[model samples]
Target: MTTTTSQATGSSAASDGRGARPDRRRRGKEGPAVAAVPVVPAPKLRRRPVLVAASVAAVCLGALLGVWTWSSTSNTHEVVALRQDVTRGETITQGDLVTVQVGLDPALKTIPGDRLSSLVGQRAAMDMAAGSLVTAAGVTKAVLPSEGMSVVGVALPPSLMPGERLLAGDLVRIVATPGQQGDLGQEPPATVAATVVGIYPNGENGETVVSLEVPEGQAAELAARAATGKVALVLDSRER
Candidate 1:
């Protein structure tokens, strides 16, 4: 009975050993066990040209916005300007003036546009061309027949006048012709200086009546010349 028991125990031990070997063989055949490794994707490369273009676009937008803001903040002012040419001593009227918007400048002194009514009937201190900006220095209380001056009207026949039309403020000379043939050769034409104040056409006589502003002392002489109908006008460019 003891021998049988020993054989049975040896068989049991052999079976156990066999089972362990198979498990080891199976593990070896399957290959070594491996731990899972985490995979991390590399970062995408930056587009340098696209980044640079985006930055430049942002800068340009900023500059344009700044310029727009500055322009909006600046303001303009209105001032009075001449609608038509005004001669020295001529009156200012609402029809002869206009309002103009101008950039504000501290050095520029001009009549305000709102003072249109106050400037009316005021005489011009100087000859101002059309579209000129009205200023404080260009106005006066009175300019007609200024001190020590007189206005005289002279009738000039077309034959005795030049083709160029006479205008106010023109410097002219009136030469007196002799009344008789005997006196023509004896004396040269008497000349006098005058400023044209106004001119009117005389359709009846086909003549032009020119009102001249002359010195008080010479008014009588110019009138005498006009009465004789022997006067001729000579434009003086040097006085211009």
Candidate 2:
């Protein structure tokens, strides 16, 4: 009975040793067990149609504005302008005008630069300052000394007239002054309404020769008073 027990123990020990060797050999060949790493997909890019469209529209509008600005600045017109000051009824001349380039509205009445010849002999209808644009209604062909009007030349000393410079279209009154002998009459001073036509220097004397346009009926009387150097000029309201 003891010999049978020993043979059974030896057989069980050999079977256990064989199972342990196979597991050790498998572990050595396979190396250490590693945990798997999870793969993450790349994040998808979201497309915003509104943002893209706005960018495109902005670029187009910028280009359009640039083009419009360039076109507006390039567009210009040649027109007539005054090179010097011209008084009312003064004849327009070539030397009095200049050709200028401007971007003007169509509603503005400006004379064309090419029509300078047509305006040379015409008269100014109103007072025009230097560098002013010439207009159609600013010139005329009417005679200067109109019907029923007479122009009288009056030479006045500085004391007889205002110190202010007088223009051609200025309204004035020629008032008769008392002579050195003095007036014996008690009547009010005789005053004649007149318009200044032109002004000229009276040689070396400190006197101004003013051409006065008055009614034909008053011309002779005004001339007699002016010749005596006993008249004073009073400026009237210049407003039209």
Candidate 3:
């Protein structure tokens, strides 16, 4: 009975020792338990190239605005401008002139404001409208009927004149046709070159009275020819 009891006790001790060895081996093989950590994704990379492009565009626009503002405010001058419409050969009076401040372009020639006084009494070389800048090519002292010239009025029907409308400063010639006295026939009918100085409607005959500026030597002859109602006005291609 004692030996049987001792063998049972030894068997129980061997079973306990085997269980303790397996537990110690498992503990050594596994690492210590650690608390679970929450995972966070990294922030997406910033769009650096897009940001740089926007900044450059803003800077360029600012620079352009600054340049335009500077140009508009810089380098201006005072010059002469016409205050009224002056027809060719019409005299310029004080009421016809005005001064304006403008930025002068190197390619455009302009008359100075100080010359406004000198422009008075001079005739316009061509038709100039209001708000036009007065230049050296605008006015001249050469009158339409200058020095030794005389103006003669001729009554002419529209059909006997050129098709184009005639104004002052037009170059024209009077061609004599069959007069009331007799036939001018051939002989190329005497031609006299003249410049138009004035024009007006004559009565209600649909005829126009044109004032021709001709030399004093030929004024009487042309007037006599026009009185016959056989004179025609020829417009020359010369422009003012």
Candidate 4:
């Protein structure tokens, strides 16, 4: 009886031991972590590694964006840099110091298409607005033929014809007949050319006075002709 009792106790003890060991295993599996967690420090993921990774990603994205923009902007047109002295576009005003398309030379007096050749240092009058057609007249100044000359006139139709009858811009024809010369010589025939000059009023003869110039060599001949010749008045054509 004692032996059987002892055997039954042994079997019960082994079964209880096995069951407690399984409970201990379950408790170990349910435990939090191997290290003791402290209340002082809050758990935080490693931030520097994540931040570095994010920065690297941003730099990569920016580089790609910049490359895309550069590719799109590849096509470009030509650009020209204008110099301060070189003229091109029209200027706005006469007082405008920043002038362009200047008429450097006025005497070039070229025809229509040649106007550009002269616009160097010369300034333009206000009437020459920019982009407008620069006519030959607009680019050049008008010149009167008699600006520089000395003139002298004598009476025509013998002595009494009035000088007031003549005006400038009028054409005249000169005629001369031979005069008494030294004993055996014949006087020279009169020489003539068309003439137009400004006139000064001459109340002395109750007529206008006119001025004329002669070549130094021809003055004596002209005077001799004037002494013996007739001066006739004619009209000039207004067309030219």
lDDT of 4: 0.46
TM-score of 3: 0.59
lDDT of 2 at 236: 95
Locate the minimum summed-lDDT window of 10 residues in model 3: 179-188
Sorted on lDDT, best first, the list reads: 2, 3, 1, 4
The list of candidate 1 runs beyond 4 A from truth reads 1-74, 87-93, 123-127, 180-183, 202-206
Model 1 lDDT vs. the true structure? 0.86
* TM-score of decoy 2: 0.68
Tens digit of per-residue lDDT, candidate 3, span 1-240: 999999999999999999899999999889699899999999997779988999999999999999998887687778899998988877788999999989899888898888789999898888899999998888888855778999999999998988888878889999987756676665768988898887797788999999999999999999998988888999998643
Question: In model 1, which range of ten residues has the least summed lDDT?
Answer: 178-187
Global lDDT of each model? Answer: 0.86, 0.90, 0.88, 0.46
Winning candidate number (TM-score): 2
Local error of candidate 3 at residue 24 (angstroms): 45
Backbone N/Cα/C clashes per model = 0, 0, 0, 10
TM-score of 1: 0.63
Compared with the true structure, what per-residue lDDT tens digits does model 4 show for residues 1-240? 999999899999999999999999998889976787777877787669888999999999999999987765663222211232212122222222221333334463323333343443332322343344343443323232225433456444424333344433445545454335424336553445434344455566544434444444555565565655444433445333
Instruction: Give RMSD to native, each candidate.
Output: 11.6, 8.7, 9.5, 21.4
Off by over 4 Å in 3: 1-57, 74-102, 112-121, 126-132, 180-182, 186-188
Candidate that scores best on lDDT:
2
Task: Please provide TM-scores, in order, for all candidate models, with all chains considered together.
Answer: 0.63, 0.68, 0.59, 0.27
Candidate 2 per-residue lDDT, tens place, 16-74, comes to 99999999999999999999999999999999999999999999999999999888878
